[model samples]
Target: MEKARGVRTERIPLGKLEVGQVLTTTLLDEKGQVLLAKGKQITRPFLERLKARGQEYVLLEILEEVEAVAATEDVPLEVKKKTLEDLQDTLTALSQKKSASIQPLEQDVRRFVKGVRDHREVVIPIIQLKKHDDFTFTHSLNVSVIAVFLGKFLGLGEEEIRLLGLGALLHDLGKLHIPQEILQKSQPLTPEEYRIIEKHPVTALKILDEYAAIGGRIKNVAFEHHEKLDGSGYPRRLFGRDISLLAQITAVADIYEALTSDRPYRKALPLFEVVEYLMGNAGYKLDEKVVTTFVSHISPYQVGDVVRLSSGEEAVVARLNPILPFRPFVRLRIKRPDGTVVLSEEIDLSRSLILTIVGEIELQSQIQVE
Candidate 1:
């Protein structure tokens, strides 16, 4: 047996296991190789095979139960709901090749820009309104929200922020022309299909040309959001200085939103992984200034969120660290003998060298354990 922080790892005999038992901790073999991951259900066949292999004991990292806390909203839910509805209508009209007014969408962008300015200090949380069927529209809204926030953080003027917001909102307008089958395919896309996908920027530019009311800057965002600074991105393959600053901002927001949101191809990645990706691509592929500003301002875990610590204990996010958003102050949950969970003293993770947040605890999982 061994213990570190609040976490305990113990060797339990295979005879103690039972069929249909769901494992909350990973089961490791004698050599410390993972035999079964956490959250997996033990079965008779697996236990029989382990016994046949003369495996008498397995290691388990015992985790404590903690009550899940609901997330508090930084952006107004009403604004997101209204914007989604208007975007859906506009996209539907454009897809059908009918005349559509972007006035409603313009108003939506203004409201979002104002919201971002008002809540400048609040850490933005992941939007939970994503639906597989409404991915295009929801993605657009998320991109717009992030872009507007980034623009404000970069100290851009109000008019520029609004235009950036509007452009981000309509950045994926070309997707409306893509066939639903190709867009929603769960399997890997072939080269031909990928080529078709790469044409979205060009398609969007063509679509935007019809709207004389839309300015060149807004059109640039739509057409150049996918272009990278390294000349590796598709379409025109433009390098640094060629891509507009607004497009660069939108590109950062677009990648963040897409990777963080659940997609048809894969599950939503953890915030830490997404941030690492953005950091890795900072100078070579993405704008260094935009990426740096984004990383410093964005918090992976929001206040009131329930997260699992490296110690195997669960904690609630108490406060954010402005300089290091990843490391924040957290209140650990103490499980009492009577099964009641209580909050312990607030621990500043930035000062603690041994403890770190590993992952989030979903409300459903907490309920199941309780």
Candidate 2:
């Protein structure tokens, strides 16, 4: 269930809705008029009306009583906060052409990657709790965090992976050159404005060259992160062999971060939607191998997420199977009218022929088996 805080919204079947779950997003009719406003508690009559309207499922916010969702907190709060602060300082100094030694910051990023490697989350939110209007630095951190996993999954050597991590952090350094008005504009830009935007990769690369001590491969990301395999990307517009492995890796990370994070223009799309876009655009626009590897690590729902299944049953995600991220192991919550005690049980969604998670929800009561 999504909440007002850092929690993401949960999509759930209408049938599993309790009598009074609070809505997070508004419910609309086919014509787009508001059927139910956000923050309204569900009721018996409301369900009947929705049933008559042929509504199947709804997105509801997490209730107040439920524990704050924490699967995405693999990076400790202290580490995440401090890293963002450090990255901001680093980027600010670089943009201003000040002398900045980023060796310590690079080490911290590598350490964060190692933590991700050990804990192994599937589609967990990165630094979701902390809010910052200036998202560029955190966006860089997210891209690097993601790049580490993708690099490892592709079997890159440790030194290469470390370089990739550093590259991810510095990939967007050029954006600091753009005027804040253009960079943070919430509307479509004119052609002239877009041309300036296209210079970021090259600009970032040059700044890195002048200010920081970084790997040769690390600088490639600043140059080629936006280049498409088909020669459609900007700057030099080099294609195929022209794009380096680290840049290609950074490209995938860059796109995913952009799609998931809130921008000046639009709110972040759902993670599942972003994954679909990546998978759909694999070969021509993005590196097919890298995109596939990153998509494999995304879980449609996080653990501790309560969801409704296709069998008219409700369950909580017990574990995420990396091999089958969508089909996570779930603990089914069975409610029986006979008043018999229901012992808890678990199911591996990948092994079950027909069972699948359809939507996520929050129960009215935080009920659990003792």
Candidate 3:
């Protein structure tokens, strides 16, 4: 197993497996495809399932230091750029009426979803290093990934999750038809421009209609992803129970992707604050159940992220705790008056009754953490 700078990897056979072993590196099949990902804390039932599948070995993470290793991109940089370029090409073709095939887009989405699932170590950080030019395509991919996780959490079937993935991926398809100047406008939009923006869902629905290969239910995301439960959303303002569940989930994902992305007008919001916003929007704008399920899948405290505890000492999130989204296992770094350093002190927050995290250790802002 190959080890990165501060991370270590150990391969163990199924018979030697024990619950609670932290996987720092993803396990791969003989063909090198990821079978299981890092940050997945081993559990008895899960381990038993792995053994039942005849899996022989797995590579797990071992910590070596408290160094601030840069967050790795979930999808490799080259892969992401290529995927975005392909998505843009597909969008251009659809807009020009040269083709009605969603095949290219679908293939990319499927590849991306599988990549993120296997590379859980970088799922949340996938968008951290995004180029501003790739925002639209990357946003679609990110939302699709988040929706896939949400669907699985809600016990949806694989095909249903695929539909959700497609819906989230194309939720903003209508935006492609809008004028570029209006879409990328740096200033606040005029009423007319805002009205035009509201029509994207309907516009996307029309485009999806031409492609009979796309599922009818999947097309609803284009029509109603913006609809609010309170009847405040535009272009047909269907309220409460009227919106489809897929559209509702896509709506939450849409809001999240938008808020966390850097826009022409503002910076991305910190993840916990965004989660707080989603929690607040439930019942009024978003489906409460879907919102609850969605947040559980988001890994907020990323590995290598330095954070401040309620106790006033600072620490780095040296490891991730799969069961706890916010509280991960942290390695404490204390500095003495003589400029000496102390490291190797690890604390698993899952078992800690005290030393709660108050907020991120401001230094994390200096580096982009997932």
Candidate 4:
């Protein structure tokens, strides 16, 4: 495995390490001298935070260092720029159309769909970093981006991805009709008030039905995305095949977006936590197939990202191997007593060791809940 500067170097065992000190561990066969194993040991300080919060694992990443390393590498800047522009334009169009009597931004939606279809991972960070305060618009766009990529991963054709994007963008259109007070409330809603919120899918279906151009599939997706596989979800409690594939995909994407985002009720869960939540709830609350696709496509770490290895060693994600989603080659970003950043040699977490992501630090600003 090729290594980069600032990536992690060792994997430590969580059970053998002290709280404050960083560690490195390996995940190779029992012969530790020959090959490294994949796993990490958590320092007590970080572990205490998780314990206090009644949490098990935390996802940790140093955003600035990761970006610094990535900045020095060659990226398809033109493609990234174009995709971000298209995403911004698409979001703007959706917002405008929702507010007025304008026609659906079909072409803009197409561009958004295409952007996601062509380059998903590269564009996701940009989308997640959007600072817009309009929760409805931004949330819709995020859902669309997630859904399109997921659909493509599921072997759906381009046309399906386009439709999925439209469905996602409009999934919560009915929320526009909700009272501003209830929608933007800072506290949990009363049981009666929560019931009203649950009716949005039905409301959205009614709104979409008015437009003859909106077909049955898209309408169903909008109305059923909240429904679950075990008949535990809202809007008629759909189960199994009763829910369409688009609805299933939307459900997974929507929940993911919602969990990763800040809300009045709570702060966002870290990325690794989000993954664990989904993985834990799969089949019981989520569509296992869709969850698999999501887990497979998204990397736990992006290039240049600084992470706290399971071993407690701080490192950067130098390279990503498509075959291993959990482990990537890393370079150690050792910290000196003087607070200076030092670079160390690289290690392949996947091959040399079985390093796990225990936690992550979310760097983006918390969006105002609405």
Candidate 5:
């Protein structure tokens, strides 16, 4: 591969760009006097060929360009701390009863809660890591992180946050005894299989009850996380006030995690879409107050996410409003022909525009699916 003096291209993709390498047209100099602005990753041979043909390089910055770079390097410090704690929690929860380490487990719970309380942008990395594994144990870790983060953000005390984290982390421990075939099946489970699966929470409660330190707290969440406010849920459905606050919080966190997770039968729904689904199920299947607080912490628009606008301009979510989760600040990534992407101007949709996010783009495929 050849190099250009003025343009600096990363070696990986350019060295491998094939004969018919496709390139998107991000800019066009109709004015001819416009200064050449740098585009995001262009092939070295393409640049050389363009220069040879006396054609100018039209600068086309790619969406998530900086994010792509960051993923390959070291994860942020807070993320590292949270990750270690999550891993430790998962390992401890999965070990047999005799091997359960109490002191380290308690320390991990405290550290995890502290990490979530310290940082606002904790969900994406935690969720991303779990998505790579997506195992039952890994899912528990993700749920715990989100639960504690939401709890702290909602002004819950540190002790409550720690209890919440530990409870969420062990909420589904009964699944450890489940048959792998039933859990890993790609198709819908039969009625018999579903019945067996439904017994997991009860089994989880029994297992938690065995542990002296975490037993009572974990039992509350494990037994009642599936129980609904209307007494419609399974495992001896209890109504309203009978369910503990710990149970309600765990229930909301469980539902949110399950919806956003890629399951055996369905793909993971985007965060905004999942929020809408939960909102629609309010009062009937979920707690309205719990959902409200959960949505507030997760942020409707997350950074590095690509979304479609009302006017058909696709943009990346840049920043989010703490008070308003439905609306966020965005930077235009793709324009409608003449409308250039103004990186300098951050559009706060909560104040200026009434734009609705249609969907999010998948980072791996770069596909925008609703």
Candidate 6:
């Protein structure tokens, strides 16, 4: 394997790899041949080919400093961990028809709402670094977090925000009933398969009906989040104002989270493209007020993040622009052949029409080998 300066290598079992996961380092075969380039999203076909070649393990270049800044900036790590654990326990119990208490989940929602209220700037990094096995739980957590952020931005009451958070957390509860093979299929789903997928919302309602504590607003969000403003959505195609505002908020969050996240079928779309999609669907498929509030306030990159520019240079996010979320102030980083790094003056991307952020650099800090 070709070794880069200041980087370490580790061998990982092929069986542990998941489709749609983006590796931080270059992947190499056991024979020291390059298997996949670093920073590329893994695909199902790649795994299949590796298995065909009788490869049981692959080597990865691990940057020592990457984990320090790996987690999303503002969200507390403990809250995220507890939420995931509670969500798994709650959902598992519900699916098995065993008696379960949502009190833990309720506490989780309170924490998420509090987090959203405390952080002035909220950013949902478009590239989801998640495992394929727990995607449903992770996706639900993300949606709830985003929904709470939006709820606070929209001036919702504290109790309302809590309801929205709890509802969003359980939005995809019915996916547990769906077949795993269909959910994990990398190929485009057939129409029949899609029909089955659409039934998840109905299934979720049936499961939720057992809980007396779940309010009508929360139930509405669980069932109607898939419904569009334009009468084109699934289950019961209730149009326009028939959909509650809380459900509308969850829908916006759900769509944004799903589109920005990597799926078994495709890689995650870029942040710019995802924002444009939300804008395009505003007033038609999604609520205009919710979309506008989300697009205007939610940031794609946080301060201190390293990003790649369209011109091939790298820069650090110095500040965020509230009005123009996609455009932020960035300071350029220049690396010299003599193993030194230089920081340039900050440039406001909103003012500079010539430059645009193309992608985020996964490794936040890089060290030179002496």
Report the number of the highest-lDDT candidate: 1
TM-score of 4: 0.67
Query: Which structure among the candidates has the greatest TM-score?
Result: 1
Q: Write the per-residue lDDT of candidate 6 for residues 1-370, one digit (tens) a residue.
A: 1111234578989998999999777999877889899789999999999999899999987644211112234456677778888998998888777898889999989887777777655444332335457888988888888888888889999999999999998889889999998999999899999999999889988988998887788888889999998899977998999998989999998988898778888987886899899999999999999998888776777677899999999999876655456777789999999989888997777657589999898634211111
For each candidate in turn, the TM-score is 0.76, 0.70, 0.69, 0.67, 0.67, 0.75
- Model 5, range 1-370, lDDT digits (tens) per residue? 1111111122122224334545442333323332223343445665676557665434333322111111111133454345445555654464455456456556667777666655535232334344333367656766776777767656789888888877887777777777888988899899999888889888877766666766576578878888888898878888887887777887877878787777777888876678788788677767777777776556544566677878687777665544454456678775447876545366666555357676666443121111
The C-alpha local distance difference test score for the whole of candidate 6 amounts to 0.80
Of the two candidates 5 and 6, the one with more favorable TM-score, higher being better, is: 6
The weakest ten consecutive residues by lDDT in model 6 span 64-73
What are the runs in model 6 whose C-alpha is more than 4 Å off? 1-73, 122-129, 363-370
Report the Cα lDDT for candidate 4.
0.64
Each model's lDDT: 0.82, 0.73, 0.72, 0.64, 0.62, 0.80
Ranking by lDDT: 1, 6, 2, 3, 4, 5
In the range 216-327, model 4's lDDT, one tens digit per residue, is: 8888888999888899999899888899999889888898888877876788787778889998878887889999878767755566666777877777766665545456
Model 6, residue 172: displacement in angstroms?
A: 0.4
| Model 2 clashing residue pairs (backbone) | 2-62, 11-360
- Model 3, span 9-48: residue lDDT tens: 5676777767888866676554456666877776899877
Q: After superposition, how far is residue 342 of candidate 6 from its true place, in Å?
A: 3.8
Segments in model 5 whose C-alpha atoms lie over 4 Å from true places: 1-96, 120-127, 132-134, 334-344, 352-356, 362-370
Candidate 3 pairs with clashing backbones: 24-61, 307-361
lDDT of 2 by residue, 1-370 (tens): 3221222345667778778788666665544556678888879998898899788876643322222232545556566667777888888898898888788677777787777666644454433432446667777877887787778778897778888888888888999889889988999999999999999998887888885467678889888998888888899888877899899988888887788667788987876788889888898878888888777665566667788889978788765555456776778776679865353676767667688877768532221211
